[model samples]
Target: MPALLDIERGFAAALRTGDCTMAAELIAPAGVSAGDAITIYRNTFVSGAVKALKLSHPAVERLTGAEFFDSAASAFVAASPPSSGCLDDYGAEFAGFLRLYEPLLDLPYVAGVARVDWAVNLALHADDAKPLDPGEFDVAARIPPERLVLVPHPSLSLLRLYYPGDVIWRAVLERDESALAALELRGGPFFVLVWRNADGVQVGRVSEAGFAFLSALCAGRTFGESFDAAPSPELPVLLAECLAAGRFTDFREI
Candidate 1:
């Protein structure tokens, strides 16, 4: 008999690639051929991945329909299997995969919608943090702007999409046909913010400047540098709004 580790590796390779020759030699099944058993395992794993993708990218699945979504998701599973055992953490690359997927190239917004879905899912699952106290913001506000760096809440994320993905995500998930119909097909440089506050995960549109500023902060830029990244007259007002909304948990003096 092959060593246990070697047998396990061979079986995994068979499941991933569907080339069961080595596994057939290593795994001696009594009733079913090793190749056939490996095929069953592979199919089951693919089905589980498809289900995970459906959960993560509901908007994409809705837009593409069930059969087509299943086909594409299966292909994705073959091309990019989960890195970990957690299915909930799978399919992070599904949006980018959709963008590169030949069949989905015509409907570009589908990928954008997938991005929105993934972002919301990420925020919902993100570890919770205590919201910044209003008093902390008040103290940070007293510090010289250049010396402070805002520490974003764990759930903060920003996306700049070339389509109105947020609208598509909401409409499809809500099953609002009229909202979908009213959306203009014109291309966009839409900016969206996804974060989990005390209430729950939330998504909202943001101005270009606000996106630039907050993204800079999220990337660990100093407050002064954020203003440099986004040179807007409304920086003060933007900071106030973020503080009010509990966008940051703390501020660091750099």
Candidate 2:
């Protein structure tokens, strides 16, 4: 029998190329013809990859139509197979891929929308934590500027797009709304923050300043330093609201 790694590599290559004959050469002889069984695997691989792509880029599919989206997914799968066993982690590079994809040129916002979808997925799968209590507010506030730190939820992600991509994403996902009428991209160069709050994962509009501020906090900047970087007069009020709303997720004192 072929070495396990060699067999796996050949099988993956065959799945990529639809080379059933090559795949058949590697399989153990069994009750069924190796070619037919290999074909099953090929189809299964395509289906799984396509499903991951669909989950990660649902907004793109909604924007482009399933037919076009499937084609793009297939092309992308053939070009770049999953490097990780965790299917949920697949398609991280899809946004970058769409940026250079010629067929999607007309839909400049597709990649950004895909990014939001991926972020939501990450948030859903992130580790759960107890939210900060009301009394901790004093502690969070009292931490000296230099000693303040933020422990962000694993699911939090910030996205900026040149189109109304987040709006488009919401319309597509919310079943109660008729998305077609609300599909126009507007208020461009949009910035958004997404995280699990008192409820489930929520997406909301944020200013560039807000995005930068949260990003800095998420990256471990102290309260004073992050505020210096953000430097917004209203930041105190917004920070309070975010904390009260369970938006901070976690933190540590420096």
- By lDDT, the best candidate is 1
Error of 1 at 11 (Å): 0.7
Candidate 2 local lDDT, 3-114, one digit each (tens): 8998888887777898778778767799998878877888898889989989877778887899988888888888888988988889988887887789988878888888
142-218, model 1: which lDDT tens digit per residue? Answer: 88888988888888879999999999899998999999999986857999988889878888877899899888889
What TM-score does candidate 2 reach? 0.88
RMSD of each: 1.4, 2.4
lDDT of each: 0.87, 0.80
User: How many pairs collide in each candidate, listed in order?
Assistant: 0, 3
Structure candidate 2, residue pairs in collision = 123-155, 151-250, 151-251
**Which segments of model 2 are wrong by more than 4 Å?**
27-34, 175-186
TM-score for each of the candidates: 0.95, 0.88
